[model samples]
Target: MFDAQYSENVSHPLRVVPLSQLARAGGLGLGAERSYMAPVLFWIAHGQGRLSVGGALRGYTGHNAIFLPANLSHGIEISPRCQGTAVFFAEKSMLPFPPTELHLRMQGVQVQSEMNQLIEELRLESLSDSPDRDLMLFHRAALMLLWLNRQSGKPHVPSVQVSDMLRAIAQPKR
Candidate 1:
């Protein structure tokens, strides 16, 4: 099921929300078919569900990461017990996200923990009011892109390395 609603605000470069919140919102904002002007990433840490992307239906379970590119129709049916986070990225950002969709079944505890940490960092950066909050968010978001690209086996140009260098330089010396 998909919703025809298309009024999502893209002013925020990124957003992270629990899957339960979306499920509670109904219209299958958790299940209904919907499309956004920006890309979306779904990280399923627990439970199982059905997802439809670009008109193809597939089943997804825990430790899964799904990426849907902008303007493509998608909808998900996550179980009540599903524990997950949805990451939305503004279409206007300069981040180097892959042009195609990805449904990654992440394996290994190390890789899973790495993805979780990166998301936690993004969530924290988003709540800060620091003068360089935007820059920090961009850097963190770029790291996420780098992680995704690497995990997906896609060739990447390493822009996040520059962000890492900038962060090192910004840190106060011990």
Candidate 2:
């Protein structure tokens, strides 16, 4: 059986969706309920599953990562035991970097050991109610992305620039 919940927040050009509270009812499938209008970064841990995105099945196991472009239909099916974090933001969140470029860079890049560590750190940060948790996690997420991009042979961009873009994306629109 499949069961899921959906929640989202919109702040004009920036939107944040917290999908961490999701729990599979039958413990069979793991991952997001559905794709969103904006791009998404999924930091999944302690789960063995396969993600169906754009009509393709991308398999993932312990400490796996996946990126979904905006409006791309995707789903996750777990092996009865799964848990993780899903962070979604708009394509406009990272200005200057074309969405197509970012998507191309992230596609087919498997999560590595270091990336898994970063995901774990971000997961712990998310569990805390501390005010700085969000900021810190955002930084870590950007770093993870940067690392992935580098591994994929994508051109290097300044980390500071990425951080700034992430901050802008996280901010509530006026």
Candidate 3:
């Protein structure tokens, strides 16, 4: 049911929707309902806006990237001048990496390049209307997820809460 391995080794299961198309038609975000589907990647090539991540509102501008975990309630409020792409990955599409949330500046060379290239490919493929677009999108999306994970630095291990510890000691379970 899960394939964390490279996408090339698994059946294609990804959908890449171009934000430019949606932007041209009408703005997205603000009204976008909070989702609980899968991890989503948002790349801003231009403009700026505010993003709501798990109830935490964050602001972003051009060249910014946001990686949101599936369980988080996420949405965006694109500015009138905002422009970019949003990737909605199906659950388990880019596996192996423990679920994580991030807001990258993309100022680093590697992060910027990988993101731009991936978005460019998405834009092109989105316009091509190819029969194998699903497979192609999957391969790129997986790679992008892996790239973001690598650039996001070391994994974060959550610290146990003191309250939980006290509760555990107060009420021992057999």
Maximum-TM-score candidate = 1
Model 3 global lDDT (CA atoms, 0 to 1): 0.67
Clashing pairs in 2: 30-78
Arrange candidates, best lDDT first: 1, 3, 2
lDDT per residue, candidate 3, 23-92, as tens digits? 6656347666365456667788888888877677779988887877765666677665777777767675
Segments in model 1 whose C-alpha atoms lie over 4 Å from true places: 1-4, 7-10, 29-31, 158-174
Expressed as tens digits, the lDDT of each residue in 1-174 for candidate 2 is 111123344332222332334444433243454656666666556666676765666677655556666656667675545655565543445432223323222233354456556666766766778988757756665666666566556644657876799799999999
Alpha-carbon RMSD of each model: 4.8, 8.6, 12.4
What overall lDDT, based on C-alpha atoms, would model 1 receive against the true structure?
Answer: 0.81
Q: Please, what is the TM-score per model?
A: 0.83, 0.54, 0.65
The 0-to-1 C-alpha lDDT of every candidate, in the order given, reads 0.81, 0.54, 0.67
- Superposition-based RMSD of candidate 3 using all C-alpha atoms, in angstroms: 12.4
Best by lDDT: 1
Q: In candidate 2, what residue range of length 10 has the lowest lDDT sum? A: 97-106
